[model samples]
Target: MPGETAPVGLTLALGRLRALGAKGLRVALPIAGHPLGLSGPPEFNARALDAGEAVIVTGVALGLVPEVFQAGPEGDVHSEVVWRSVPVREAPPADVPSLGEAERELAEALREATEVLSRLNVAGAGPAAQAALEAYRARAGRGREVLAPGYPPRALRVLELAQRVGALIEIAHGAGAGAGEHGAAVSASEIAARAEALRPVERTARRAQVAAYNAYVEELERGGS
Candidate 1:
């Protein structure tokens, strides 16, 4: 809104959303071959893919993906963020796994990924990267709400599993790619295989994340919390 002709205001944005007869927001995480939660007009899908995320307003044909602009010199740089709304189609939500199913799938994925890494002899990262990974795990383990209050607790569990899966993906990619200074690169064959194996898990992680983010809206649509 700040970049618009009328200038910025949250009220203006809310009013526009209300005028659209909005029901709730649905999250989209799109990637090639997998439009995770998007059912779209190509324009909206393309923008969301570029942004790597979007929010579609259910019960209406509209979506918003944010873009940030930065300018000015280093010491006094300026930046602005805008949610660029795009036209979308109102379609049935993408079929995503339930929390229980996600958890089970994530668990199996974790096991398979671990075995793959271990078999390929790329399971452990360099000391520094290992420490960083441990720190991240500790942070994730802290009791906290993964989403806003309106979302059910199961969403939190799914989010946590998704994050764990993401961590595994990172570890696989990092170890395979020789990320840290002290890290040794795995064989090209292993790297290729690792990537091939983790692709589905990575997609699952994205799907789970979108599901968790949109869970609140799903609940609202069903007339429940």
Candidate 2:
């Protein structure tokens, strides 16, 4: 059951709550079909403990956890027996940065790369080189837009890295094209020099992206634990 996909409603609800930065959520178990929300087999309520536990485990795996309630006519007997001894909350260390903060750091690093590209002086460079530079600038603009908030932390990191890498490659290609078009105007050494200057900025962006991704995974591990 752990390997199986969670029911659609549970997945959607959990995603929504995480996006909203909610804490201390609770859910009623043995969810029935239609108006009651997600449905399981007829024996769902009979195996409420196992089913409910499975859902919670799955949620934890997805970087979220919700308190589950399975009350009957007497009320809360299940919780009293099972969850009574369990600690309800634990605060993370104050120094631990949130996913949003990590994302911002990565975005800033990528913006630095763009700034380096924009400042490069390619005056008198041939049309081919100018075209390549323009393309790289356009990609940089698009990358900034993609870095905007809303996506899950991991997804956002992946997207941002992809955008930066693409732009970098395009810039490299443009530099090569410029060199070829204006063999006299721009020496091969000039193109190489420009690329070398960009290398550190690109490396910085990559390092920041990796750090952000690691922070996100660590947060998930802590939440699951």
- The digit string of per-residue lDDT tens for model 2 on 73-180 reads 775366522221112123322122345554565566566555545555433445665676677677666646543353355756654664565455355436456335
Backbone atom clashes (below 3 Å) for every candidate:
0, 0
**For model 1, the run of ten residues with the poorest summed lDDT:** 175-184
| Tens digits of lDDT, candidate 1, 1-225 | 223575456577867677768778788887777777777888888998898888888766788888889999989999887788778887865556666777777778778767766765554556644765676688787876668776798888889888877876776677333333322344676657767877877887877787777778777777843
Per-candidate RMSD, Å = 3.2, 18.2
- How does residue 69 of candidate 1 score in lDDT? 94
> Where does candidate 2 clash, by residue pair?
none
Find the number of clashing residue pairs for candidate 2: 0
Top of the candidates by lDDT: 1
